[model samples]
Target: MFRKLIYIVISALLLFSCGGNGDGGKTKLVFKVGKVAGQSGYLAQIVEEFENENPGVDVVLEILPSITDQQHQFYITSLEGGSSDFDVFALDVIWVPEFALAGWLESLEGKFTDEQLANFLPGPLKADTYNGELYAVPWYVDGGVLYYREDLLQKYNVKPPDTFAGLKQAARKIMKGEDNSKLAGFIWQGKQYEGLVCSALEFIEGNCAGILDDGGNPVINSERAIEALAFMKQLIDDGIAPEYVTTTDEEATRHSFGNGNVIFMRNWPYAYNIFNTEGSKVKDKVAVKTMPHFEGCESASTLGGWQLGINKFSKHKDWAWKFIEFMSRYETQKKMALNVGLKPSRKDVYSDEDLVKQQPFMAELLNTLLQAVPRPVSPYYPQISLVLQAKFSEVLSGSSSAEQALNEAQTRLTEIINRRK
Candidate 1:
């Protein structure tokens, strides 16, 4: 009788372990979604809404590190091992090509209708597509823009400069008139990291030069490219930008500008919200414009944002796609924009009357978003970016001329591309 009781007890434990959460014996399908850490409260609300709509589906949020490089490494380690731990995950715009090439992301072709796909901005849509297949859906969009002290410009009777020469002239005039030694004429990301690549690309592409041609061949060593890089270096030597920018990243620049010590800043759209927040020194006194271009060239803003993809090894592929679709929906995107200050990937979201009213800056940024350009779209971009960060740092640090840096970058980038062929 003791042996019989032991068997019954073991069976009861198994039954309880297999049972659902008191839902009339119905099992819940749980999906894990991974994203870089930020805006957790609003995201939790979004997950709750998705859960309510789906009933039997539960979403577990897996927050990754805030640093982009760290998040990339984490995905590499997990996806390389074919881990089915995460059902869906966020992809940096630049990572779509790399991840798609590795077969770590499931192809999203035919998942979105033509009308639905067309609603997305072209730059992000292009980034998420590899070869002829779509591998991810754009969650939000970002582009570099010029943030300036609006009150200062108006106080000095200066117009917003559309050309780099005009910007420098305006900045110098403002700095001299303000007579504050602590004030910087301009600021940007100059640290040897992913942000440096984004900042450099804007200058390079603005001068009608690019790191890679449309065919994915290195073209970063051209005369125009050299001139662009040299001009960036000149900004520091001339004292228009601080020498300490060599160690500055996005947040550092944002803080400097927010403290009201900057005349102009080159940063992403996310800074707009922060600059206007309560207690900010520059509150209600800042405005944005497209980055300035050189003569006979057009302005260029680097494409930067995140996308969503299903893990290729996920067990719940269908539910994963549903979550991605829900996240990419107009309502969801609008909530993100309204609550978290993320720019929407959907073109229609930008024109929504409510969004325009609450965030008028979104309307003003439409042209900049429309003209933004992507960095090199090769699957080996991560490798190429590292070479660029090193060489670009050399130029900025006065250790190498622009010509020397670009030539070295060109050689290293070519070798990386050749390996792919």
Candidate 2:
């Protein structure tokens, strides 16, 4: 009995010495990533899985509020302060340049070798790279798309609209019906947020040299840009869309849609799950497609979504990279598509048999993502985004004519660039 007891005691001591109760244990790396606020439920599930796979890491995830612009602003202040508390940040595609230029991110060199680069969707990966150096990895991709009420369009005996004008006409008939005045012809993000920039891109693709030209100069006040904003004004003035849309952002517009109060809306695929979930009024009846364009305008879709990054101050860089590699693998990626509605970055994942069964829209969604254009990638991008949002809101609200708004915005953009220079 004594010999047995001694053996047990020795085993206990050895185990205790190894790690018990956090005594001289393995290095504990506290990593942080951003999540959309109120969406912690969804992201927490992913984080829990990650923590389980990486037993040596203790992760702390922070979910900022819905406004992505504010989250980026938080990054600017927090990272600029040199706080090493966060080892990873959820980055937006355009913020790659700012973070990289500020030297706030790790080299990522030798971490994600060229072979692994083949896993990412080309557009998103390109968005995260700058001057031949990659600073982040594409987390998920998003593209602008139109959501329409299938039943209402069917009632009108009309096919899905092929052009913007056709869409306007379809919305008018639906709203005029006795049971549908409460329904808007069109609803979208017009509030002064990053979404405004996203929502407006469908109107002016291949024009105005984009928000920032190839050299990162603001092209907002160009003739083409004025025409684009004017189209928005025309929509409201002509009664195709209600005037109050000026105050609507993502949540407001989404709320209106969820209540079955809008004939059409433009939003990212993230809302697909929310709109089709059990309680939504339009469940199983809403149809989604790429944002339609003006008759002569080129079809355009704005790109937005999260990017994965490694913190420069992390001591366990190699281990953290391994986790990233695992998360980005083809098997893991398809699982993410099934688990969360996140569109994948890999080409093959789009065609996975399970994904096709889950979302017949996957093929169409992938096509849009492949062709979508990334917003300007630059250290001064946040400023340019603000300029576009302000002018766009003013023009849509009738407070400023499209011409005047663009003219003023152009001057401000030029001044900002000159100052930076």
RMSD of each: 4.1, 6.2
- Residue 403 of candidate 2: its Cα lDDT? 87
Q: What is the lDDT of residue 118 in candidate 2?
A: 76
Per-prediction TM-score, please?
0.93, 0.88
The candidate 2 region of ten consecutive residues with least summed lDDT is 20-29
After TM-score superposition, the amount by which residue 188's alpha carbon in candidate 2 deviates from its true location, in angstroms, is 1.1
Off by over 4 Å in 1: 1-38
Q: How many residue pairs clash in each candidate?
A: 0, 0
Task: Kindly list the per-residue Cα lDDT of model 1 for residues 194-224, writing each as its tens digit.
Answer: 8999999999998999999878899999999
**What lDDT score belongs to each candidate, Candidate 1 first?**
0.89, 0.77
* Residue 185 Cα positional deviation in candidate 1, in Å, after optimal superposition: 0.7
